[model samples]
Structures are given as C-alpha cells and as structure tokens.
Target chain A: MTRYKAVIQYDGSDFLGYQIQATGRTVQEEIQKALTKMHKGQKTVVNASGRTDTGVHAKGQVIHWDSPFSIPVEGYYRGLETLTPDDIAIVSVEEVAADFHARYDVSGKEYRYFVKRSPQHDPFSRHYALRYPFDLDESLMNQAARILEGEHDFTSFCSARTDRESKVRNLYAIKIMPTEDGWIFSFSGSGFLYNMVRILVGALLYVGQKKLTPAEIKVALDKKDRTALVSRTAPPQALYLWEVFYEKDNKK
Target chain B: MTRYKAVIQYDGSDFLGYQIQATGRTVQEEIQKALTKMHKGQKTVVNASGRTDTGVHAKGQVIHWDSPFSIPVEGYYRGLETLTPDDIAIVSVEEVAADFHARYDVSGKEYRYFVKRSPQHDPFSRHYALRYPFDLDESLMNQAARILEGEHDFTSFCSARTDRESKVRNLYAIKIMPTEDGWIFSFSGSGFLYNMVRILVGALLYVGQKKLTPAEIKVALDKKDRTALVSRTAPPQALYLWEVFYEKDNKK
Candidate 1:
C-alpha cells in the first residue's frame, strides 16, 4: 500500500463541510467516490489536516490517503484533477511513508477571516466577505488581537459542543491587516477548537466597533466561560483555512 | 427638477444586461423600480453609460436620472443603499445639469476582462471569472492586443444584430497586464459595437493559444468582413465595465 500527501484547495459554498454526512453534498464523499470509481471497486478512505464547516473555504488544505495501486506521485495530481469537481483542486501531491497521517502528524495551522466594512455592499465581493456596515477602528481591533496570542484555555471562544475536554491551546500569533478593500484577521495556532477562530474574530470585531474595549477581550479570556465571549460568530464564507505546517522528516 | 449622476457597481450575474428588456430582469429596470418605489407616484428614467450583456459585471458604471424632488446627493446614496438589492451598489452620486446625458456626452470608457488560466475551477469565482485550462502565451496575446489599438471599422468584431449604422470607432488603447492571480485585459475606447469587447478578447485568446497569429488579427481588421474574424465569443462573466471617463467641468 502507498500513502500520498495532497494539498487541496476548495470553495466550500455548495458543500456540507469536509466530512460526509447522510444528507447533503460533502467534499470528502465526492473525492472518495471518485477514488473508488478510479480504482474499480476498491474502497478508499481519505484524511485531512482538519475538517472545515459548511460554507467555509480553503486555499492550502492538506490531506492523505492510501491506495492499493503503485501510482506515481504526479499521477495523483492528474487523477484527482480529472475526478474532483471544478470547485475543488488538488494543488500538489507527494508519496509518503506508510505511517504518515494527515491529521495525526505534528503540525500547526493558520486561518484568515475577511470582513467588508463598507456601508454599501459590493456585489462582486458579497459571497467571499462578511459585510459589516458599522465603521471599524482598526487600531482598536489590533490591540484586541494581542490579547488572543499565547497559550491559554480558549473555552470562551470555542463552541460549547466541542467534544474536547482540554480547551487549552497555544495561539502562536494573531494579526489584523487592513487592506484597501477590507480587513483580514489572521490567526496561527497549534490547533483550533470548533468555531474558535470565528468566535475570536467576532469578539475583535466588536472591539473595533467600540461595543467592547480591548480590556473586555482579556476579561473574556480570564473568565473561561463561553458566555463571557462575544456570541456573534463570523460568517463561514469569510473564513478560510490558509495553511498547514508539519514537522520535517516524518513519513507515513 | 434636479438631475443626479451616480456611479454604480453590480455583480450582473442575475441581470439581463443594462437595457430594459421585456422578458428578463435588467439593471436599468431594477434601478428604475427602486427609484419609483422611493418617490411614490413619480416615474424616473435612468440612462446608463452603455448597455452591458448578460453576466457582464460593472465597477464604475455611470448613470443619470431626473427627479421631481431635490434630494440631497448623500440621500441619493442612502436611498439607493436602502432600495437596491445586495447585488447592486451606488458608489457615489453627484448633482448634474439637466442636459447632462450618461451615454451621449461620454469621452472614453474603460473595460476589463478576466481569464483564469489554471486548470482548477474555483467555486467562489465561478460567477465572476472565465476559466481556461490551456496554456496561453501572454507575450503573443499582448502582441495581438497592440494591433487592436487606433481607429478602425470593427465590423468583423461586432455582433451581426448590432443596430449601429457606423461600425467605425476609435480604440484608445488595448493593454494586457499580468496579475499575480490572472491576466487583466483593459480596453479604453471612444465607443464599442455590440459584442465587440467579447469578440476582441476571444480573438486575442486564440492568438495566445497559437491558433491564430498577430498578423491574422491585422488581416481581420483590414478585411472588415464579419465572417473574417473568429466567431468564438468570450464568456460574459469575465467582462467588466470598469470606468467611464468624461471631461472635468463638463457639468455631467
């Protein structure tokens, strides 16, 4: 059996997230079905660095799968390109050791959320961006982002239904970059809990609107209660899984 | 009565072009309906810079409309903000002379066409871009574009159904700029014939693929026979009316 690592990009608008559900379309099921068809009755299981929710997007999502055939690494690209829908693309592929795993391997991830602050909606950008009509103070938002960095129990920012018992995680960095079009809030971390990035972005957005001060973010962090943080979640369309980094010399 | 010149932007995915059509939704009809809604019992007519085809987008389309009431220019912005659908936005509004016309007094117009050269289809970008899998020689495309500049009778490029009597027009410039993501084709012209821009882009694209040569474009121009030019019409989604330039102090 050969294991292959694939870097994928997808527009998650028409998908019910990455995982296969009983109802609705999914990215995983579509790719796995394609693989099964290509292999002629051989079942295939695919794993990803992380599972994204419905309506979310990804630019550099990484995944791995085992195949019965001894296919060249380049063949994986061409095969997936032909099999996957237009909304999904396998950007790159490489063969890995038998033990290599996409989700289990040691690594970190980065995510970005975009918000459009203009009062008038830009028809061209409406789908990919979250529209916020209120005026935002970028400096204030930047100040709030600093509080999110470092290791802490991010219970307040995580979804309440997250199955993990340990809510503590290390946040490597958080930066808010203002662009001509809008603001991009980027977060890098060892890992993220369900809806953690979206909730964190929501809290910072409130700070930018002066609904909450920079100090409020610290209070929310210290409280460690879900209700302590801002409840409004950023729209999934504006969120994107940007990259995944893994430890070198690790083979599948 | 007062007239206002408004700069508009629209996605155009759901619009049947800028003209008012009997059987389909149109940008002009939508804007007029919005205006009539705001000024109850008052009918308003809107004149646009030019008519755009179905699925063609706009970023800086200019229009002029007369109103019986003297509405503040900012109110025009706010009113449109409330009335226009999410797919349309009034970027700016300025009071203009009663004689000012959106289509007649134009000095020059700028339009852009986008082509996604990658093999992968982007779900988020499906409504706004044209994807071409074949490799295109940018240098060759630029060479063909240069030949399209200056005045010529573009009968070979215009749609057969175009209602214009004279097919001669001045093409101020045709520039193909390479962007990090895709190619940006910009055309500045005094005026354009029906389906002219799409045909021009199609021809350039064919040249880029080595199917046609720059010299062939010159030959097509010289022939002036509609059948002499390439028949493939570029998709409308990739085209955008970026700007309409008029003389300053022209009171428009």
Candidate 2:
C-alpha cells in the first residue's frame, strides 16, 4: 500500500463544509466520490489536516489517502483532474511514507479574514469579503489583536459545537494588513477550534468600533465564557484557510 | 422633464449585451425594466454612450434618461438601486442639462482588455479575463500597439457588420501594462468601430507570439480590408468599457 499526499485548493462557496454530512455537498465527499470512481467499486477514504465551515475558502489544504491500486502519481492526478468538481482542484501530489498521516502530522495552520469597509454594498466582491459599512479604528483593532498573541484557553473564542477536551492553544502570530482592496486579518496558530478564528475576528471588530476595550478580551479568555465576547462570530465567507504545515521535510 | 445621467458598473457575465434584443436579457432591458417599475408602467427610454458586445464588462458606463416624474436625484437613485438587477449597479447619478445626450455628446472612450497567460484555467477569474497559455513578448506587442496609435481609417479592424459611413477614428493612446495577476491593454481613442478593440487586441497577440511582424500592423491599416488581419478577434468577456469622456464641461 502506498500513501499519497495532495495539496488542494477550493472555492467552498457551494460546499456545506470540509467534512461529509448526511445531506448537502462537501469537499471530502467530492474527493471520496472521485476516488471511489477511480477504484471501480472499492471504497476510498481520505484524511484531511482540518475542517472549514461552509462558504470558507482554502488555497493550501493538505490531505492523504492510501491507494488500493499502485498506479503512477500522474495517473492518479489525471483521474482526479477529470472527475473532481470545477470549484475543487488538486494542485500537486506526492508519495509519502506508509506511516505518514495528514491530520496527525500537521504542526500548524494559517488563516486570513478579509474585510472591506465601504458605505455602499460592493455586489461584485460580496461573496469573497465581508463589507462593513462603518468606520473602524485600526489602532484599537491592532491593540485588541495583540492580546491574542500567546497561549491561552480559547474557550470564549470557540463555538459551543467543539467537543475537544483541551481548549488550550498557542497563537504564534496575528496582525492586520491593509490591502489595495481592503483589510486582511492574518492568524497563525498551532490549532484552531470550531469557528475560533471567526469569533476572534468578531471581537476585534467590536474593539475597532470602540464598543469594547482591549482589556475585555483578557477577561473573556480568563472567564472561559463564550457569551463574554462583545460581538457575534464573523461570517464564514470572509474566512480562508491559507496554509497547513506538517512535520518532516515539507517537500511536495 | 429632468435629464438624469447615471454612471454604472456591471459584471456582464450573464448579459447578452448592452443593447435590447428581440429575445435574451440585455443591460438596457434591465435598466428600462427598472425604470418602468419606478414609473408605474410608464415607458422609459435610456440612451447609452455606446453598445458593448455580449459578456463585455464596464467599470464606468454612462447613460441618460428623461424622468417621467420630477423627482429628486436621490429618489431616482434609490428607486433604480432597489429595482435594478444584482449584476448591474449605478455608481453615481446627476441631473444634466436639457440638451445633453449620452451618445451624441461623447468625445472619447477608454477601453481595457485583460489577458492572463497561464497553462491552467483560473476558474475564479475565468469569467472576467481571457486565458492564453502562450508566452507573449510584451515588447513586440507594444511595438505593434504603437503603430496604431494615431488617426487612421480602421476599416480592417472594424467588424463587417458595422454600417458607419466613415471608418476614420483617432486613437490618442494605446499601451500595455502588466498587472500583479495578468496584463492589461489600454486603448483611449476618440471613437471606435464595432469589434474594433477586440480585433486590435487579436492582432497584437499574434505580434507578441512572433507569428506576425509588428510592421505588418501598419500594412493592415493601409490596406483597409477586413480580411487582411492575421488573428481572430479576442473574446468579449475580457473587454471592459473603462471610461467615457464627453465634450465641453463633460456633463449630462
């Protein structure tokens, strides 16, 4: 048996999420369906580094699966390129060690939340970026983001649906950069909980609006209460899984 | 009656063209429909600066219509904004002089043709840019573009379907600029004939590919024959009506 790793990109606009569900479409289902068709009637499974919510995009998602048949890597790519949906594409593929597992080997992750502050609705880019039609103080937003730059129990930022026992996670970096189009909030961390990045963005937006002080973020984290957040969770459309890092020599 | 002028933007991916047809939806049809709805079934006619082909986008298209009811400019804008299609939007509106005309008062126009040279199709921007998977010599393309930068009878470049009496037009400027994602060919001219810009872009692409010499562009213009061109017309989706200039004071 040969284990193969794949780098993937997806629009995620029409997908339910990264994982499979009883109803609605998913990125995992599309890949598994393509692999199943490639292997005739045999079942094929793939494990991804993480999951992304509906309407969230990804440019560098990683996944691994053991092939039932030892076909050439090019052959596998050709089959996937022909069978996969238009919105989903495999950018590159490589053969990996038999013991290698995508989710278990993942070391870190990076995510970005895009925003456009405009008084009028931008119909063209509405699907890709959040349009906030109000003024936001950039200095306050930055100060609030600085408070989240270390390890903490991120229970207040995570959604209630997450059943993970440990809420502790380390955030390596967080910053807000202005782009020609708008602003982008970048986050890199060891791991993220369900909607953790989105909720954190929501809190930063409130700080920018002057509705919440930067000190409140520390209180929310210390109290371990989700409702302590001053703002609602940000929408999924503006969120993107930028990259996934793994241990060992990270080639291909 | 107040003469109202509107500067508009549209995606044009699903539009047939800017002109009304016997069947199929046009930008004009949508605007007219919105105006009719605003006027309680009263017929409203709008005059556009120029007609764009199927799937051609516009960042700043100008149009004028005489309002049936004397309403404030904001009122007209509000009604159109609420009734217009999602793909089409008015950026700004103003009340113009009584003698103002959208088409007849036009002095010049600026068009932009976007090109992406890539081996793979970009599904994200595929609807807006033309993808040509070939190496293009920008120097050669610029040389070819320079030869057509003056007043000339563009009989060879104009489509055969055009019935304009005089084929003479002044091309004030033509230059190719590189973008972060792709290349853009900008053309600012006093006037353009039907399919003139697309056909010019086609010939420039051939010149860039070394299939045709840059000097041959001058020959085609001198020949004044439609069939003398070396390349096919570029697609309409990649073309954009960037700006329109009106004579004296430049108002409606």
Q: Which candidate has the top score in TM-score?
A: 2
Query: What's the lDDT for candidate 1?
Result: 0.88
DockQ of 1: 0.53
**Pairs that collide, model 2:** none
* Per-residue alpha-carbon lDDT of candidate 1 for residues A78-146, written as tens digits (9 for 90 to 100): 888888887897888898988888898847999999888776678887767898889789889888877
TM-score, cand. 1: 0.87
Task: Mark the 10 consecutive residues where model 1 chain B has the least summed lDDT.
Answer: B118-127
- Report the error of model 2 at residue A42, Å: 5.7
Residue B7 deviation, candidate 1, in Å?
1.5
Q: What is the per-residue lDDT of model 2 for residues B138-211, given as tens digits with 9 covering 90 to 100? A: 99998888899999999999998999999999999998998876689999999999999999999999998898
lDDT of 2 by residue, A208-229 (tens): 8888888988788888888878
Pick out the ten consecutive residues of candidate 2 chain A with the lowest summed lDDT.
Answer: A119-128
TM-score for all models, in order of appearance: 0.87, 0.88
Off by over 4 Å in 2: A14-26, A29-44, A74-86, A163-166, A248-252, B20-26, B40-43, B117-121, B160-166, B248-252
